[model samples]
Target: MIHLKKIKIVETSEGYGEEVLKKGFEFECGHVNLMVGDQGCGKSTLLRMISNNSKHLEITLADHVITKGIQSYYFDTEKDNPRVKDPQMYTSLSGKDEGIGYVGALTSRFRSHGEIMENMILDPLKDAKDCVVILDEPESGLSIKNQFRLIKEISAAVERGCQFFIATHCYPLIEAYDVMSLEHWKTMKGEDFIKLAREKRYDGTEKDNSD
Candidate 1:
């Protein structure tokens, strides 16, 4: 399990004021923790703050810090750019004549979006234990069917003791796991507010906003 006491952010972009999460939030590992919110609601920022590989943000993992000796992988689809344009180039780069072997099998050597995700991001870490996987909108180019498939893959990883911190707006993906809704992070007036609510299970019904 991992606990975060607080997270503070100072906006250095000229003219933008400071924003701080004075109270912070906490969530347990060993299960998928989904973060859902509107754009600019700080979902990605919070993920960055908790990530071990983040360069700009400073984070302190308080009690039950399991990050030490744990292999962490962060997959940001927006910034992913494969140098090889085709399967032949990939084969040459990888030094393999056939398809790129992944997840204990051979997959397409072509550089399609979904294939890229499986080959570069998901397949390598699916069976890992005691690791932390952070994905920022991994459902970018996948179809609805593929999104659900990805969810099942992640669930399997979670069952194997791998922790996942996912930042996404996909409704089906959000419904498929334990979720921490960041809806209360902002108000109609556009100010920072702390409302951390954890839903241990999603019942396939509409989200409850009574809190």
Candidate 2:
């Protein structure tokens, strides 16, 4: 397993300049590691920095050094920027699906966001091995039911020796993984967050919609 001991970003030139993290933010490494918070709380920023493998960021790994080019994959529901740019890249990364013919047309035209994620994200993860997979708000386009289903896909990837770093607010995801709250970069109790989510509260404020 890829054991990420800690991460610290001191300057903007290095990575996401968000200063939400205290110096030397730390967490225990696990099969499914999560960074959870409301929007603009720096979750995506941290994930972005990790995905870029930013040299300026101080990332202490129990197993490997960050500069040695560890094989990693990054997936955002909004972007399909995987570490390796294969021919099968999807619109989730580039804002445009560059596929052609039947498969391409189907992916870009007929599929909903959730279906597209399943085809482009979860499908690749099904066979991922011995690498880190980073996801930013992966539950963006899924329904509550699909959010739970996403957990199954992620769990399968974990069983295959793939370590995951995910940024999310989805209650199901927070409930299913070990999570840190970007609000303080401290361990968060999933049960508490789940209770808040059920009440449509995020970041301690009541949201207008239900979970």
Candidate 3:
């Protein structure tokens, strides 16, 4: 299991001279840690701070610092950039020397946004363990069926011991994981966040649509 015991940020020259976006925020790592909040509510800010400010934060796995290279996989769904070159490589590397027909078929199959994510993102990390996956609103371009598929894929990865930090507003996606709602985080009140983090299980019935 992984643990994030605290996060602290300071701005010396900003309006308030200094501010703490997060302090003593704690969560036990699980298969999924869904972060839900309204726009500009510091959800993405927290993830970025964790991913980039490793030097200043105290995050650990099994009593040791998490120092593995590429231990975190971030999928910024807002960008939606497709890798047009990878399909050619995938076909050629697949060793199916059946020529252009195979390549064409493979290319056509991954045209949808969800299929591209499955082939390019999820498939590669499906079996990953003891790592963190940070996704920002992955439901952006996915259909309901594809969203369900994404949930299953994430769950499978979680079963393999992967930890997820997802920032999303999709109701169905929110319903599918243990969520920490940031609706009140901007107020710097840690009670609600702590409660959700400690629960660490969605149970599929709790609902919070304010995000």
**lDDT (10s digit) by residue, model 1, range 1-211:** 3333333342222221114332334333325767666566567766766674433334445445534445566656665424333333222212234333352232333456676665655555555555567788888767787788788887777676566778876667765555555655422211111122233235524446688
Q: Provide the global lDDT of candidate 1 against the true structure.
A: 0.54
Q: For candidate 3, report its TM-score.
A: 0.60
Per-model C-alpha lDDT, please? 0.54, 0.68, 0.56
Pick out the ten consecutive residues of candidate 2 with the lowest summed lDDT: 81-90
Instruction: Name the regions of candidate 2 deviating beyond 4 angstroms.
Output: 12-17, 64-69, 81-107, 196-211
The candidates, ranked best first by lDDT, are 2, 3, 1
TM-score of 1: 0.58
Off by over 4 Å in 3: 1-24, 54-56, 64-70, 83-115, 186-211
Give the number of colliding residue pairs in candidate 1. 0
RMSD from true fold, candidate 3: 9.0
Task: State the displacement of the C-alpha of residue 41, model 2, in Å, after optimal TM-score superposition.
Answer: 0.7
lDDT (tens digit, per residue) of candidate 3 on 61-86: 44444354435666665443343332
Q: lDDT, candidate 1, residue 150?
A: 82
User: Who wins the TM-score comparison?
Assistant: 2
Superior by TM-score: candidate 1 or candidate 2: 2
